[model samples]
Target: MERCNHGTIMRVYRTRQLWGSGDDTFGRLFWSFGPSIHAFSRTVRPLILIDGTHLRGKYKGILLAATTLDGDGGLFPLAFAVVENENFDSWLWFILLLRQRVMPVDKNNNEFTISSDRMKGLLRAVAEALPGSYHSYYIRHLNANLLKTFKSQKLCKLFSRAAYALRESDHKEAMELIKAKNEKAEKWISEIPKENWANVHFKGARWNVLTTNAAECFNNVLKGARELPTAALVDHTRWKVQDFFHFRRKAEATWKTHLTHRAEKWLDRSCSFGSKFLPRTCSWNEYEVLSSTHTDSADLEKKTCTCGLFQTMGLPCGHAIAAMGLNKLDRYKYCQDWFLASTYRSTYEEVIHPTLDRTQWPEPSYDLLVLLPP
Candidate 1:
């Protein structure tokens, strides 16, 4: 695989047998494509969404995936592994490999925010493997659990509102509504750490992503491939990823703006809304944006706004846009580089070379060991 797809990282673990012609058996496997890893390191957001889906091949196991969102809000897969089961050890092994081979902490001490379901094993794995990183729970999963316990749609909706709320006050108001409706439900939500599910409390930027939907979307695309043999599964993923890169590369070439289509649309909406607000200059970089409803403080120097959307979404909020317009500053300059078209181009710049036929492969110098499925 490495020879075919240069720079690919693949590892296989074997378990020793206690009896009978003692031969090692397949224990686990992990792989990350060269292009995918390079793309993520160069351009994608630091947030990773992880999830596991059961495989239905002859040797039944679980397929674990680590995915991220690209600059254009598209799903970009980083790494994948197949394990016998979803346990603490298995999850820990995968995460460790992910850190070492895919997203190692550099001299700058870059950290990532990992989002997944509240599985006991995965939670423990992330804590042990990435102590410095922020971990978040999927709000959809949390809401589902809340619904299962309370059997109330209204409570679930309120819980979602609290999780999605951008400001502390808004989040507090949503919680109070929940408390007024059902004290037990409010208590149940309070038990889980706010940083794990609430947007206002999370220490890291989530890019407004609240769920493992990106990973799920990749899994759905691999639905049929999940039934293939181990080798075939890996090959299928490679081809699919290659196609994704090619398609996106062509699509990006047609873009005329400095930002992605999604980013441009978001900025346009904010700009239109901001036009209705009046900006009162407090300083060269600070301004008070006033509207009929409320007043918001926007600091162009800090790239922040009192509305909370600026820092949270990594994009200019309506208030910030209004402030930028007042100073005649380029609104695109205030946007994060992750949304830049240049970054998107760099992500898909590398070509994913196709693998040669197996029959033409060279023999290994070392003796081949007979292996059995776990």
Candidate 2:
């Protein structure tokens, strides 16, 4: 951990007792990639996904992780903490540090969107640590909770449709279908805050991330190192992250398109879906996109479709695609800046440098001590 601070990698690693200089058991430790701070702050999207998993090792603890999304829609790990448990205090400690060092509070308005499965003590901690930021719940977790209340695959399917609905009308349609199946299911779904899972009501840019899967995917990547001791585990992570950046930096340099691969794929799919829809130009900038089942209004100037997907997903929806095709507009123009390959390449432009050996490390200005966990 000390070696990681060599040239500004921004890593935090410590072992503290339950009681200061008295307790034998260590409490918690946190780690983060330092250079990722500047890179993410400038290049990556403002979305954050946090999750915790139980460590199965000699020392039992919870591995809390915070991750972001790169321009190519890849996971960008930001910070991590190994705590005694996933509680309010533990989450608060990690989030506060994350805010101060990386995700700082914006004076204008909170630009960050944090997505989670609504873990124990997390909601309250986020409320306290980042009141300005938006909190979104993972739909899969919410559906799991719903299943606990009422058991049925049909209910889960309906709930998923409702959660994925991009327009208020579409959301209501799905909810109404669920209500028709069982009012209890509908009421149970309503109990959850709409903005937490409903894409149409979410306050910030979710970037199409509706689950905590990004963090989970990274956790899977670290599966082999979880069994190692603290120092080796951290070093393993550092090496893996460095290699990831190096490989992506080199691989993306040979790309052909202006947009990232994922963004281009999505655009292509949207164009295909649009081709199936009938588009009728109503005016200079307005068009009516009609399908057999649904009709949507599209405004090229506003960059919006009545279906709401165009504005929410930051990608041209089928309706918007059809309208753009009719007007001979470039579909790439509607994409967010973060979806560009240029931005994705810039995310890994800086490299993580090696650190000196512990014997050669500089002495600390002041000795830092940790208090025992209460």
Candidate 3:
């Protein structure tokens, strides 16, 4: 009990008083344990990456977390908080703890970077809480969202190009770089706020690499655990958090890693960038992805061919990838319109991870993004 509560139980049982310190028992444990854990991690390196993992025990809750990477291809779990939901308030608590750990005095501490998805509301809260801290979104989430949102193979190639720019250098140059190749996303300029595309000056390069991909990855780790009870779930969550760092350790040994990515670089961003769902209908001659410029060819403009693969069969047509590549494109980008990101993995997984994968999934193509080339 002394070790568990930092002498609180002894002080309580002997003195018949709650506590003389400003912090409660739990607070004491948290501060002592938290700093020790943080200090140990700092010895390895100064990054304190964070994410909220879901619980699989009898308790149903979200696990908010902070972590760091070491020079020896290892991971150190820094701090964590548990919540029942993933809203602004809950996410704020997680962010606050993370900020407190990184910038103790709020001075120039280049020791850490924050990563997350391009989620607007939650990010806004993070900004308000910690001004001038680095915050980036995950490229995987952006790729997933773009693939899921654009839904058109023709537009996908262009979007991917822009995304590559955002993922590569300063996110601010996206339109400048890819706008000529794909004017379709120009409308996003007016839709998204300015800060979403802002950058942080890093070692001479102005850019960002922050996103919620870590949390999403953590969420995937928590898949089976989400249904568990609270205590059991939190216990497992702790174990999994440790396991994540362990895998991360191995992954680091195998590959270079930063505790966080480039997405979380800019703490301040404008809401100038926005999402647009408008489907396009460029003429087949203009639709470089098409094999031929013939409207009468129902299969081509209809996002299919006589092969009946893309639109009907649901899986990509060997012919589609072939046609798309002829114009320099990524085949997987087209899988999004098929309905959901959940669907594409079905085909890939229904045959792989049988324990985690499920079959009987829906076809990729359900409703067309637009009516026609009007």
What is the Cα-based lDDT of residue 313 in candidate 2?
A: 69
Compute the lDDT of residue 224 as modeled in candidate 1: 99
lDDT head-to-head 2 vs 3, winner: 2
Q: Pick the candidate with the highest TM-score.
A: 1
Backbone clashes in model 1, listed as residue pairs: none
Error of 1 at 66 (Å): 0.2
Candidate 1 on 80-118: residue-level lDDT in tens? 999989999899999999889898446122368888997
Each model's RMSD to truth, in Å? 2.1, 3.2, 20.7
Q: For each candidate, what is the lDDT?
A: 0.89, 0.81, 0.40
Encode model 2's per-residue lDDT on 184-270: one tens digit a residue.
889878888898889888877676688777999999988987777766777777888888889889889889998998888888899
Runs of candidate 3 with Cα error greater than 4 angstroms are 1-36, 39-41, 44-50, 53-60, 72-76, 101-111, 152-177, 189-213, 240-374
Between prediction 1 and prediction 2, the one with superior lDDT is 1
Q: Give the TM-score of candidate 1.
A: 0.96
For residues 47-92, write the lDDT of model 3, one tens digit per residue. 3445655555553555665554332323344554555556776566
Q: Report clashes for each candidate as comma-separated counts.
A: 0, 5, 54
The TM-scores, one per candidate, come to 0.96, 0.87, 0.46
Who is ahead in TM-score, 2 or 3?
2
